[model samples]
Target: MPVPRRLFRAPSRSLLARLAALIALLVGALLVWTLSTVYEQRKLMHRHQAERELQTIGRLQAQAVADWRTSRLADANALTDDSLFAQAVARWQSAPQTEHEATAFVQERLRILQERARYSVVSFVAPDGTVSMGNSSKTVPDAEKKALAHAIESAAPAIVEPRRAPFFAFPFFSLMAPIFDGTRPLGAVWLVMDVRTSLYPLLSPWPTASETAESVLVQAQGKDALLLTPLRRHGELETPTVVSASDTARPLVQAVAGARGLLYGRDDRNTPVIAVVNAIAESPWLLVSEIEVNEAFGEAATRELWVLSLPVSAAVLIAALLLGGWQWRARLRESALKDKLAQNMQWLESAQKAALVGYYVYERSGDTFTLSPMASELFGLTPEAPVARTQWLAQVHPADRAQVLAGLDEALRERKPLRMQYRLVDGSQERWVDMWGEHDAPSANARMTGTVQDITERQRAEEKLGQYRTALEALVRQDPMTGVANRRALTEALTVEWQRAARIQAPLSVLMIDVDHFKAFNDRYGHLAGDECLRKVAKALARTVARATDLVARYGGEEFAVLLPATGRAEAQAIAEKLRLAVRKLAIVHAASGVATVVTVSIGVATAQTKTAMRSEELGRAGAQANAERESLHLIHQADQALYAAKEGGRDAVVAQAEAPSSTALVGSGAAPDPTVSPPPPRST
Candidate 1:
């Protein structure tokens, strides 16, 4: 028993027990460290993912808002460039009392635009910012007066920022387009839009399904940040939806402060949120896309809990092995991805260079451009330097500068895709360049992205082709010997005049002239003399019908036709008589002539008094045009019948048919009737 006391107090057993306790403690510590590292890394990864998603959404919403602003400006610009609308506005402004027609026209146009364009109100504002005419009400709110004045004073289009007006329950904005009569400022076209109907919906939708995710637009006002859009998550905003701009912790305030990119901040509700801030291009507003922090980190929290519950020793060992293996694999994967990315980048660069196409990003706010190597080369600039707006414009040829700037202005104003071909001055050489540009999302900066290609050779080829086409068209429409319109050209002219006469309820006249004895003259003097005689007759007829609107054409062999728009029967007949005299006055000797000793022509005249107005429903219809064309052919038929009558009655005479031939004819003096020819049949009414 005494010996057992010594064995019971074994030091080896005590030492083993202490060692075991130390090992357990070390394992516990390692597990704690590993769990902490894993949890932090997981949270960071989740937060980064959320930030990326939020940023993407923010950019997209910012782009949508910018596009909306641009579209409104475009709508205004459309009216500004419309000459008809401008003339109406001018007349209404200058003589509102006497110009009832102009007033009605302006009102109707404004009404149609309001209804079709889905605007709350479309109004014409006076230069003094007074509502002169409108679709709904002629009231210019005090809030919008400043913007209207700016638009008119600058003689430019402008956007009124969103604000709650006394007349509207919800926030509203205006698009003002100034109207100018030549260099004189007339007024502006004001378009009012209810933000709830037009813009709020753009920010309402979230790309992914999330309960707390929402997009908002913010604008800085003095020392406050005003909420431009209603808070989608928190429901309708209260009056004076603004927060202190000094509150940098608030996402809206941060957005207004021009802080872009992802950040951790509290929302208006004081709830912690992860948000991405972006500025809307060409506007004072900023877009913030946010989600509750709790929701974004929920999955990471659950994973952390599971890791914490694992047995300390086993979990620590497993984590170490997994970490090592993951790091190894991640390195390999990253290396492979880097190589692939390099290869893809090389391919893209080579393709761009080979195609002679270069891309550029334009910072609209900064008035600067960042060009790729190819783009820089195309612009004849150093590749390393960013191009300024002025420098970029200077690269454009002088002849094309205004056009290019105008196009760029329109593109930026509308956020629309642009395609233009213009000449560029590169060094001492001028080269033609075709450029295509499109709007990129206005995230961090307002920008335009596009490609430019050297198209000098292509433009030259197209110009040459156009010249050839013009020459061919001339050959097709003109007679080679007479240098006057041919039969095909005459037919086209007749159809066009007939339609015009029908539209305007005007009179149309046709004169058909024929050489009395061309066949006999040709037989006696040969083809060369016949040709010369025809040329003379054609020249005389062309000279006789001297009005710019009138057309004289070689109808066929030895025959000519004249088209007189807005001419009555009396004038037509007089012109026909003059043409006959003009030809006979040439006095070309024709030994075989029966009508006179000299060459003479018989003329038939027919007039169409289109006094009947076309029905309103028939306008702009293809079938109606076809019918008009048919009526024109009938007119030609009437002229031909009169020509036959003139030939039959006697050579070298003029026969006119307003509807149907009433008299025999007006025969030439010293002309004998051809006994062999008979009177022609009556023409159809």
Candidate 2:
């Protein structure tokens, strides 16, 4: 066929050309705006991720330091209760010449502890701050006498801040636990630990691999913030540098001044950094987890460059296509048109690759998928051939295959947008992908077009955050000493169980168990043996309570509690007796305990009657919930009173508190009680 004359006309500045130019300009501007918006959003997301990571590290380091401090204090407390060691000290002090064995025993104990606990020095200090016995010949510094006095007066374990002593080569801290003879305070057992060996290492490891990331332990010293641990930037130092508290740009100062969470500040080198601050529990210090701002946001900057380049590249391509179309208008033919279309397809593929997105079109009639090159790569398929429906399905993870298929079928049948996240499997590898699809032409051919994005990194980050959260929660709710539920966990469990029981109109029972004359036991055997005794008792109590719903918890020092859900007074009493018998069977000798030659437990049992809870329902749901909480507390109070009655009567026994008409006028059935005795006040869990 002969070419039309208009098709071969010369290029001119006509209305159509002017309109096309204007449209191109607007499209280019819109493309830049969209890319800029995406770039900004990505930067914000990067900043948020950095802050989250810093905060996680800060919390973790803070928790670690707190645990370390607790362990030190625990060691001190255990040493203080060492009756045999205390007697040895007493004999050595009274008569050093005649009591050579006592002197040798004290020296050996200190030496063994110093080696075993990795302490720099272990000493028995007298009330006047004199080192009576020590593993090393180091003398106590005059500057630390005040701390010794404080430990003796408080009669509790105390931590001395890390400092240098003439006798020690490296800076060290002291853990002092007061030694006592019954009610009178003797001296204190001093534990000297080198910070370099013990504490500084905890802050060295970063959760993610990075050279500039570090943790700093800072203490507020009046007008200055002292670095307790040396910064990684400075390598090793004989002494730490103190930053002025007035430096508002420093995260250490901000941390001491009560600022927490994310902060943008500078470090010792005055380099800008992104940091998170958290206070270490029970200590006058704060933890700063920081990284250089440049290092932290380096990837974001690269992404921004790429993000900007894409729009400019698109503009260039658009202009070239426009110019090429104008030049080739006169030579329009099937082959040339096909070549132009092929260029457009290449550009589309490049854009898809740049965005890390894969596109696919599924034809229901042929049960085949036409995939872009990126899509074929994502599915681990050959790009030269179309993929069958079965092959596509086989690539999906077995766990997520059914859901993906259902989403596809629904989108095709219902003619709606399909959006879901599922996993893809290729050999031994698994990946998470986010997908979105819609019917290309709902009224015509049943074709579904979709885009898939890899989100595996995001999934892994979320899972890691969840694990940290779980570990933190476990630390908060668990008892470090006995490996049982702490008081906080017990209280939370009680609240939840009470609410559940109230909902089902079931009975709830509580048991309060106390070791008989536990103070005397500690005084007789020393704190270490006392701790062992408590552990054995805890284990016995745990084993005796056979129900999965029953919880055995450490209520407090020398006290334990058991929560029994859906249990009546009879069953509760039986369980309490069994728990008592279990401890008796342990045959742990407790000569100090007057109840028996062996250790015994006194248990108080109280059950919340179903009738008592039924009355709470008369109030609305909110009121019922509130009343249930009050009832739970009241139940504990009754148990406490019953425990008192068990103690009043002979020690090794179980006393069940019987409910009366008034709730307050409850009496214990195990022991004779005054009819006029009123119920003890409700106690907070």
Candidate 3:
């Protein structure tokens, strides 16, 4: 009866239970709204981050492609500027009878270069669109010939568009540079490199480790975007894949139209992707880096869900315990916020460390410095250690200390922003740092605050760039084979010395020396041995001319020239005799030589008294400067005439042509040249 009565009375709801139910409903609604807001914000943030990373990768790939093309063009230009090649071309152009020999020489050179540079083909294109000389037997295409003509007309190097070669059916591109004889265009030298092997590989590598990320190149073709390089994911598709310009959904189409920055578009596969585009400098190509949108954002969504769930669960637990533990709950919430703040600070510090950056505050009046933890670590000091101005200065590299100090003083006096780069030596280690600081208006107790970033990598890159510049200059001025000054360098030195001689009224002497029976020597020992012999001769000549002002250069094949400033005919003749003897001392055997059993030289010395105006016509003409330059050429002609005279008077002798002396005179006239002084055993041809 009692149980029946209690069940019928029904359970009366407790105040706590009703309040708990209401609280639960409110908390659930709040969590739903907050999670939605957080998810959207997180989604936007992830998208922005992906866009930034892709943009950076796109820009880097574009720069790399541009640099690669630039380097190839530079190589072609350098080859065209070769003195030996120019002289050979001049000889062939002036006298068609020498075509056979000149063609053989040029073909040999092209073959060597092709092997060294790994080119598909290298050709010398004549003005009439004929292949004068080439490494490959393949005929030059009409399109390539027209491009070469354009390059010759432009008087600069040109890069042709990629095309498939008929012979190998492989993709290739041409680099052409006009060959010049002073102001006259002497055809063009062109190189064909396989794009599949040389260029496509450079653009295919993605900077990111993610498999979904890739880089591609696109060029505008009519009203469509043409894929210039292969896609990493879809390797089966042939390059130059065409996409309509109206396809705004395609990143490549947008890129071809010069659209840059992050964009949402579909890839070739029609899959949604996040892409960044950058235009290649100096070319009508665009570099695109893209990642599948789903792949890029999947993890972000997962992380966002977890983050939202964690806060919701924590809030529900707090609400459940609110009735009996309100004070404890409040403390917990405060502590949680503090922990979050601390976590954010920790994250900021981590980011700064990763970027190799640090912050600092300098008190000018106290001459003391306060460094952030990262800054202290960069200086190889404990974070807790007090930093003094003197202590900081002591860490600076000895070589850079003066500049750093002066820069700081200037910045303080001017009350302006300061930017400086210097090296820091901590113990045995050295690091490069870029410091940027700004001070407020000058006052008795002004403070300077700014950031310091470690730029060691940038410094290394700059040093490497400087090294490359030095190497390029060496390629321009130094002979590749003999490691001496090239003809171009010789010409420049001659012009400079001529002007200097005119100013100082000093004599300028030139020695034009030729290796006797060099052709016979090459035929006897083969071209490889011939090259070795030339190197030896060049070394001997370089050793003979040790003065700082003296220059020894490879003028042409089997020929060398030396420039001597402030030297009279007598001194020049003595130097020429010394050079002749030096080559003889090498004892390179030559049985075919009529001059000597060993290698010998014919030397012609010419001395000009630049103080006096030798040509009256040059003195009166308005273009006297031009005529004076022509007089320098006249001096070279006089030296050349003497060279022929030396060869005429048998080899291994020095002939001098000077203003005061007769037209030509042989040096060491009394003695006959030694033939077997130190001759090697001759090999029969």
Candidate 4:
């Protein structure tokens, strides 16, 4: 400044100035790039909003269907209550044997039930499927009546069927429940509800005016389905295409094939439309909502247009006129910046080395790459030469490579964060590393910036934790030696099964299993070997029962309980026989009988769907109205009687138990008893 130095002597333009100029040029370019990036982010946000809207509709569908099914189930359960049928049958059965007496009794019942059950009519059927009594317009048509009497259900407390009625020629969901003489099916009661009107309130505000959307209920089977149209979207044509499970029209079949939740409907052409589905509880139906492109993206498209242009124009305006001198300075600055950039890059390399972690960027579009010193160390490099990702991957364990790529690809495609643990070799020795990454979609290649850390100790701890959890879970539920449920487990299972049976008209059965001569056997054999014998029997039970619904548990002492949820008596009996035979096969010594053979067990079978089923299947010690409740007394009495009967009849057999209905017995209780009922025809071994 003092001497007014010439251009050559202006301190060689100073490296700092040059670098600052280069930074300005780079910043200008970065500002343009930043505007583009912001535009993309806006577009992504709008798309995300659409996804959110669809997800909301999906939840709405699920809730609507659940509400509908719950209503129907409640109606069905109320209609099939045992008390109503018992009252009708008791009056008819107790009185004179004349047809006129029975017909008169039936006519009175039909009128009372039609008013109470909110139905057009109600009718009665004898054990032989004959309609002995009815005052209703819908009598048992000949076609259904022929199939009704020998309906193969010797113990269906209630049944549902399709029948002809005067109100609607088209068949509706109909049911038949029997009055019981102990375990016998005496007569039947039928109930029906109109599907469309009864279910209208459940599917409300559905064809959402905000979006041209409608929700439908479809029944999904293996590959075919039944459609129940509840709501219609705008512009959606009601093309009733009845495609079968075995339809040869490949496209239609595939579209409706899974017919799972959240599906779209297309015209006969199978064009694209967006749909979402949710399944109704306990019923074979699905609730689905569909949206058109216009409905789904109309607002988003408008938002995208506004979001794209404004920032870009501002960036362009800033880039013009005022930036020319900056550009000249930037060009000169770039050359000097190389050295400074080298220095900054060295800091990154040093930072990675100090941290014992590695940084990596996976570029989906380009093969170009760079590695820090720590990354080089992880990939078996000598710290003399840098390692490329492709070469580093070559050193990765083969089993892990496919998994790593899958994680990487997923991160790249959906722009989702990813994490993975895998092994890599360093100097012929394996080292485990855990990696975490953030997906960056702004990059054309959809890159990931991730960090990796050695996690060999963490993996070992995880394995130990898994084993501990399994052991703890087993301790909570299982018998130590037998690998069956303990008392606590059985109680939980009973609650779960009871709720399920109540929800669906599905049957649930229980067998109060007790080993016949266990005290004698234990007296002969030591407790250790007795424990072993139980283990053997439990093993047999585990093998013999075919269905997953069956659960075996040790009740207390030598007694065990088998919970057969969603099973009828026939199925329960089948499993019981298998279990009984399986115990005989074990051959544990019965010391009292002087035989070194396996112990035998007598099973008391009870089913919720049986005509004489008890409400308190396993009577609790206390209840809501303890003094007034006869169910508490009846169930305990019946179970004890059945146990005594099992002992009386034989050592190894099945005796089903039900309570005898007394005025003292609770009216709503499921138990119904008759003295004349006998054991079912003996099942073959």
Clashes of each: 0, 1, 0, 12
TM-score of each: 0.44, 0.58, 0.55, 0.38
**Model 2: pairs clashing at backbone N, Cα or C within 3 Å:** 81-527
Regions of model 3 farther than 4 Å from truth: 1-341, 380-386, 440-444, 613-631, 658-685
Residue 343 displacement in candidate 4 (angstroms): 32
Candidate 4 lDDT over residue span 442-540, tens digit each: 767666677776656545645664575555455657766688888667766666554444333345566766677665666777767777877887788
What is the alpha-carbon lDDT for the whole of candidate 2? 0.76
**Alpha carbon lDDT at 517, candidate 2:** 83
lDDT for each residue of candidate 1 in 641-684, tens digit (9 for 90 to 100): 79879988987989997553212111111123334433222222
* Tens digits of per-residue lDDT for model 3, 509-601: 889898888878878888899899989999999988857778999876777899887787887888888899889999989998988899999
C-alpha lDDT score of every prediction, in listed order: 0.75, 0.76, 0.73, 0.56
Q: Write the per-residue lDDT of candidate 2 for residues 1-685, one digit (tens) a residue.
A: 9988887875564655566556556655655665565566556767777778778778877887897787677678878877877888788878989999999888866765674456877887777777744354444776557777788788787777876667677889887788877767778888999988788877886757898999988888886888888888786544547888879899888988888888899876889999988888888888888899988987776876685576468666755577457545635433444554464466556555655578888787888988878888888887747789899899999988888898888877788898999998867889888888878775656788888877777789879987877776686677667888876678778877776654454567899998988878989999899999999999898888776677898876788899988687888898899899999999999998988999999999988754323443355667666655666677887897799799889989999999523332121121232245332222222
Lowest summed lDDT window (length 10), candidate 2: 664-673
Per-model root-mean-square deviation over C-alphas: 26.9, 11.7, 13.1, 20.2
Q: Candidate 4: lDDT of 204?
A: 46
Error of 2 at 484 (Å): 23
Backbone clashes, candidate 3: 0
